[model samples]
Every structure is written in C-alpha cells, then in structure tokens.
Target chain A: MKRILLTLAVAGVLSSCGNNDTSKQAADQTETAHNATEHEEHGDHDGHGDHVASSVSGNTSVNGPVRKSDQASAILDGYLAMKDALASDNSAKAAASGEMMVKAFASFDRASLDPKQQASYDDTVDDAREHAEHIGTNSGKIDHQREHFDVLSKDMTDLIAVVGSDRTLYQDYCPMYNNKKGANWLSTSKEIKNPYMGSKMSTCGSMKTEIVPQ
Target chain B: MRWLKIAAVATVVVLVGIQWIPTPLNRGDTRADKDFIALYAPPARTGTLLKTACYDCHSNHTDYPWYSRFQPVAMFLGNHIEEGKKDLNLSEFGDYSPRRQRSKLKAMSSQIEDGAMPLTSYRLIHWNANLSKADEKAVLGWLKSEIK
Candidate 1:
C-alpha cells in the first residue's frame, strides 16, 4: 500500500511538470505570434512614418546619430510585417503584408533623397515592388511567395544599405535554401528564425552582416 | 575473360553513343558587352583574373575546354554554367536591377572571403582560375568600393 502511494505521487508530479513544460512552450509561441501580428491590419494606413516610428522609437534615435528616413522606414516596416508573417507560416497574413509593401513603395517619395540614394531607391524599390506584388497576388500559395521572398529579402538588404534603417538589423543567409543556391535577407533580430523554411527548417540561417544605422 | 570483354565493349559503346547527345551551351544572344567587367572597366590584370575565375561558369559565353566535347562532362559544365549564371551572370549583370547587382557583388565577396566559390572541383581542373590571397584582396576590395 505504501509503495503504491509513493509511486502514484511520483507519477502525479511528473505529469504536472509535463503539463507546465507544454504550457510554457505554448506561451512562448503565442508571444512570438503576437509580436508578428502587432503590425497586422497596420498596412491599411498610409501614415507609415508614425506607424514605423512607434515600433522603433525608444533608445537608438534618442542618442545615436543616424535616423531612419520617413520613406525608407515605412518600406522597412512593411518588409518586417511580411517577414514575420512568413516566419510564422501565415500565408494569408504574408499576402496582406506584401500588399502593404507594394502600397508603401508606390507611395514613397524619391525626390527627397540625394541623387545617388534616389537612383538606388528607384531601382531597388522597383524590383522589390515587383516581388511584393507576386507575394500579394498569391494569397494561399506560400511556396511561390517564399520563392519571391528569396529575392525580395536580397532586395530589402540592398535597399536598407542605400537608404539606411533606424533598427539594427542583421543580414542573414540560409545555405540550404533554393537547392543550396543560397538566399539572404535582413532580420531585425540575431535569432535564426528563417522565413524561407518555416517550421521545417526554421532555425536555418546565420547572421552574415550587421547593419547599424549610419 | 568473357564477362570482362563484354563489360569493356559496353563501356566503349555507351561512351561513344553519348557523344551524339546534344548539350546546351551557355552561348546566347543575351550576352552583354556592357557586362560587370565591362561596366567597371577594372585594371587589365584584375579583369584577367576575373575572367579566369568567374566568366567560365558565370558568363553567357563559356569557352569550352577540350573535355567539354565529352557527353557527361559537357552536361556537368552546362549545369554549373546555368547555376553560376543564375547566381551572377556577367552578361546579364547590366540587366539586373541595382539591388540585384549589389547582392551579386556581395555574394561574390562572401564566397571569395569564405573560400566557398571557384567550387573546389572547378579549381582542381582550372588551376589558372584559382584566386590567390592577393588576388582575392584586390578583387574584393574593388568590389567593396563599387557595390556601395
């Protein structure tokens, strides 16, 4: 009887620990999802400066010199939204975010930048807009969207290089992507949550370059 | 002895038969005179190094080696050329968007720095294409100044 009671108690403790572990994992996933969705429904607004600024408002711009340009920052915001959506494997949201990117790029003012920056802006933004439209057009087709994202991420990195960014971003690369043809993208974090291979190879890429604002 | 004779005959026949198989060459009307090399107009020596190291696989015009006439090697070179061009084609460099050009340059820089490119198999065969340390520094340094 004593042994039976002891064994039952140990089993109860193990089960409770298992439940806690699962709950904690669920909570982490939810938090990550929430962070991604924070930019959701945000694409509808044209007030990109105010929107993008809010997310990256605090420490960097307060003390450090270089600030994100209004037009560039808005584009970055749209990219981040699409990237986060794809990272979470949300094709529907990825499409929506891609649409926002098209709108953001279309509405961006090029005349405001210097001649060199403007030239780069014109080319990179145009290329990125094409990829964004593809992603936007293919609402349920995540694989196709991912193919475009492969190049789009490279586009975004080049854009940020020319236009600069408020956020300290990392240029990440996944060697396993596109039959080892290799693909690259800009990420706001150093963590290896690959947008290219969602879930299957989520932690695939490594940070290759650090992009700190001017 | 009979089995060995049969195997030898089969190998010869297969090799001879495959010679008739047509392979696609990288040669195309899409070749650009205003290529990456042409655009930058690097020093003649630098240009030579680039041509030796890159253009064989990364250009629209791939000068076939003697072995490229062989069936399987021709096919292998064809595939490598296609993949290399897909990544960064000098002939199509002018056609790529500014972002793409920069990205390709960056890719080249990384590949060179990390020693991931010139693909060991390629370097083993095309010894002239091997990029020495000084060659790497000069080419990458020029690219860094240009890409930005």
Candidate 2:
C-alpha cells in the first residue's frame, strides 16, 4: 500500500507540472478574451485617449484602444488573418488575406462612424486601403509584399491609436528588418514571433507594446 | 564517488556525440552596396573597426572561428548571431529609411558610450574584438559628428 501511494504521489507531481504550463497558456488566452468582451460592451463611447470616462472617479485604466464599430472589428479580423498568414510564411495566403482586408476597409461606411471619429477614420482607412491593395497585388513577390505589410502595419497602428481595437493586440517590432531599419506589426499574441523575416528569422523580434482596448 | 565517475563519463560521451551535430551557418555573400559601410558611408577606418569588432554577430554573414566547428560551441555561436542580428544587421542597414538610419546610429552611439555593446563576453574569446577606450571615444565622436 505504501509503494502504491508513493507511485501515485510521483505521478501527481508530474501531472501537476504539466498542468502549470497549460494553466499559464490558458490564462493568456482568457486575458485576451476578457479584454475583447470588455471592449465590445464599452466600445460605444467616443472617449479615446486622455478624456476617457473614469467609470468610478480616479480609475483611469479605462482610457482606450477602442475600435468602436463592427466595421472596425471586421477589418481587424482580415488584418489578423493576414498577420497569421505572414507568420506562417504563406505568401499566397497573405495576399488573399490582404484582399480581404481591402474589402473590409471598403465595406466600412465612414458615415456610420461617430461624428467625432469620422475625420480620423477617413484619414486612416484610405492609407490602409492603399497599402492593403499593394500587398494583395504582389502575390508572387513576397518580399515586396512584406514591405507593404510593414507600411500597412504602420497605418494600422495609427488607426488603432485613434479609434482603438476591440480585440487585444500587441505591437511587435523586428529591428533587423529593412536592412536593420526596423519595422512594426500588430500581433494577437504578445510573444515575439516575427512575421517580417518569415522562417529564416521567425523568432527574431520583441513586443514593443500592447494595445488592449480600454 | 562511484556515481560521480559515472556522471562524468556520461557527460563526456554526450559532449562528444553532440560535436557531430551541425548548426546552421550564417554565411552568405551579400552585395557590398547593401552593407552598412557602403550605405551610410561611415569613415573608412571606422567601418573596418566595426567589422573586426561587430560583424560576426551583427551581420548576415558570420566569420566563424575555428572553435565553431565543435557542436556545443557551434550552437552557442549560432544562437548569439541570431540574437545579435535581430537587434542590428549591418548587411541591411542601407535599406533602412532615413529616419530609421538616424535612429539606429543614435542608439549605437549611446550603447557604445555606455559600454553596453560589443559584449564583454565576446572580447574574452576574440581579444582583438576589444575596442580600447580611445577607439571607443573616437567611434562615439564620429557618430556624433556624422549621425546628427
């Protein structure tokens, strides 16, 4: 009986170690979901940046990355898909996703946006659309497509800065890209799996910052 | 003591076995026009100094040392080059935007002055990689004059 108990104890310890890693991964996913839901519910408000309503009084953590409309969310889905395709180094898939992004950008009616956000949205969408088209058109030329992706990422960053994203995002950077010129992209995961360098330098970057919705 | 002998033998065997495993070599012939010296045009002497001290880790091509032929050492050197190039790649420096070029030059200068670069650990193996105080000062001076 003692030997059986000892064996069980060892098994339990080993299993617990496995559970620890799973729990950490689960926590990260849960945080992303929690932030997404929070954005969806609170997204209707026009307060972005410094003027965010302090739900209570002194709590300013609710400041923002608030993409307040369905149009914005749809565009993000396409952008995320493109990001994943690039991460996988699938040029054709990336090009397809880029086309989807252009459609999403076009589908968004600027008139539907809150009057306060209209000017920024109009400014951001046109630039983002142009880059998306470039990325989509260059299906065979992956390197050139990636360059456009980098520029698209910058526009996306600017867009998110103004309106904010409903989903959690991380702004990642690879310093070695563009001949060590450095480039930025948005990622769903905080981990620095670079999309720019593809397989040769897949893990060659770091999270510059996070863009969780307020 | 008996267990220690067994452990030592096991370690030696593992070490020898690992030596046969090949690591990826970061050696490629990239064109000169794309290289940092050619792109930004740092002074001729300074460019040479940068190559001697920095290129092995911070460029696409690594000038591997004799020790790099061994397994564990090869892996270590490969990992270092991967990490180093992520932060700075001299071979692609010219391709950077003008703004990015200035930013990197500024960062390099600061890192040099702070003694946070050309990592001390690297200098231990390749003593020639060590930049003297005067050389460091001169590099920093050149950066100030040229970069800004």
Candidate 3:
C-alpha cells in the first residue's frame, strides 16, 4: 500500500510540472494577443481625425490633404515614394526618394509642434537621416538599401504616429524576412507588395493595421 | 511487493522506451561567413561571453548538454531554441541590413544592461551562462562600440 501510494504521488508531481509549463505558455499567448489588440485600437484612434477631415472636404481620393502642416506632408510624400520604389525593386529610385526624405527631414518645421511632438520628431529624424544617407549612397547595393529601408520603415511609423500622414497607410508585416524575425512596412494600398522582399517575395506579407490621416 | 516490483520495471521501460523518440537537435554543421562572430569579430573575452551566454538560443548552432538527449528535456530545449531563433539569429547576422544590425546591437546592449536576457529559467539550468558584472560590462562595451 505504501509503495503504491508513493508511486501515485510521484506520477502526480511529474504531471503537475508539465501542467505548469503549458499554463505559462497559455499566459504568454494571451499577453501577445492583448498587445496586438491594443496596438490596433491606438491606430484607429489616431486615424479618427483624418477620417473626419476627408469627409468634410468631400475628398474622394485617399491621399486627401491632412490637418498637419505642409512640412509634415512633404516628409510623408518622400517616405511613400521610397516605399513604392523599394516595392518595385528600383534601387536607383529608392535612393532618390531616400535623398528626398533626408532633405525633407532636415527642413521640417519643428517650431509649430508642441514640446512633446518636437522631442519625438527630433528622435525620429536623427536616426531616419542616418538610414536615409545609407540608402541614398548605396544605390548599387539594393539588398543593403532594403535592409536600411526595413529600419527606415520603423522610423516612418514613428514619425507618422506623431505628425500623422496625408493619406491612409496600411501597416504590412512579412513573416519571412529578417531571419523570420519578421519586418513591417507601410503601404497606401491593402495589397502586400513587400518592400522587404521586393519582387522575390513581393506578395509575402499581410496587412496588420491601417493608419488613417490624422 | 510483487505489484511494486512490476511497477518499477514498467517505469524503467517507459523511460528507456521514450529515449528512442528522438528530439531534433538545433546543431548546424556549416559555419556561415555571415555569423555575428565573423562579422564584428569582438575581442576573445567578449566573444566567449556571448557564445556562452547568448548563442545557445540566438544562433543556429546550440551546444546542447549530454542530458538533453533525454526525453522531455530535449523537447523543452528544442522549443526554447526555436523561439529564441525567431527573435534573433546571430548565425545569420551578416544577412541583416545595416540598419537592422545597428538596432539589434542597440537592443542587445539594452537587454544586457537591464539583465532581461539569459532568461531566469535558462540560467537556472546553465549556471555558466550567468553573466557576472564584468562579463556584462565587457559585452555591453563591445556592443556599444559596434553599434556606433
């Protein structure tokens, strides 16, 4: 009887350890899901203003004028141009757009922005300029340019979060890029023309969220 | 007494039987030129620290322990390796874009400084993987310089 009881107890303890690991994994999954939902909600809130502006102006074009200053629009225009070029696998055009972005970022009017917005803009532009320079100078190295573009996309996302954009932008994610670490890029259309993979795996990504002009 | 003896034999049988259900190892034979070690070539000490502390999960090759050949434990480690590679693959570091390389370096520095890496569960088993203050400083210093 004693041996039987001990065997049952040992088995129970071992099984409980397996249960703990499963529960922990479940909790992690729930947390990730929660964070994704929160991100989507935040994007929707920022896009609300742009939705109102487009409706009021009766602008049927998705690229309607935004409430932001002209300087911000110029930066967004340059960024979108770069995004399109990268998608088309045109390194020379991407480099030109990158140079345009660098210029736009340099001349951006921060005086009109609030103190907090100024801080964010400064942080975003500083890194952005470096990435843009790398992209602009390495037109022959499309792979290198795409690598910088991946990071530049992130900087653009940060910029858009603060200043908003003149058009609705879809945030697309490619699971195959960056050694399967994945990468995100912004697009005007819902279709996934993966900027990271270009023509090689052009339709590899899926739209994660949409950023409406604020 | 007879029932207890039978149970013991059955348990041993189960343990030995499960060993044959091979868990796939993360070991990669080919050393890629794009490996993090090959790309930046950190000082010997810094390289050792990174290999010992981070590479098991963050790289394509894992120096698995002998006990890992056992059932359940091997699967557990295999899962961890898969998850870790999904976040960052140091073996494929050379393939990352310049911007990504910079950002990953920055992230490594921050994670080291914050002591969020070499995860608690991992450290519990692999004591040598624990980074002392000096190890942390050396790795962080190398990472800081590399990012620039």
Q: Which candidate is the best by TM-score?
A: 1
Clash pairs detected, candidate 3? none
Cα deviation at A166, candidate 2, in Å, is: 16
lDDT of 3 at A110: 81
Instruction: Rank candidates, TM-score, best first.
Output: 1, 3, 2
Of candidates 2 and 1, the better by DockQ: 1
The interface root-mean-square deviations, each candidate in sequence, come to 8.0, 12.4, 9.9
**Clashing residue pairs in candidate 1 (N, C-alpha, C atoms within 3 angstroms):** none
The TM-score obtained by model 2 is 0.44
lDDT of 2 by residue, B1-148 (tens): 9999999999999999998887988976566887887776777778878988889998888888888889888898888999888667888877655545554576577567667678888888888878988788777788866553
Which fraction of the native contacts appears in each prediction? 0.31, 0.00, 0.00
Model 1 spans with C-alpha error above 4 angstroms: A1-214, B30-33
Quantify all predictions' global Cα lDDT against the true fold: 0.68, 0.66, 0.69
Task: Report lDDT (Cα) of residue A23, candidate 1.
Answer: 70
Off by over 4 Å in 2: A1-214
Interface RMSD of 3: 9.9
> TM-score of candidate 1 restricted to chain B?
0.92
Clash list (residue pairs), candidate 2? A65-A164, A65-A165, A66-A164, A67-A164, A179-B92
Residue A41 miss distance in model 3 (angstroms):
20
Q: Residues A33-90, candidate 2, lDDT per residue (tens digit)?
A: 3433443455423212111112212333432434434447778888888887887788
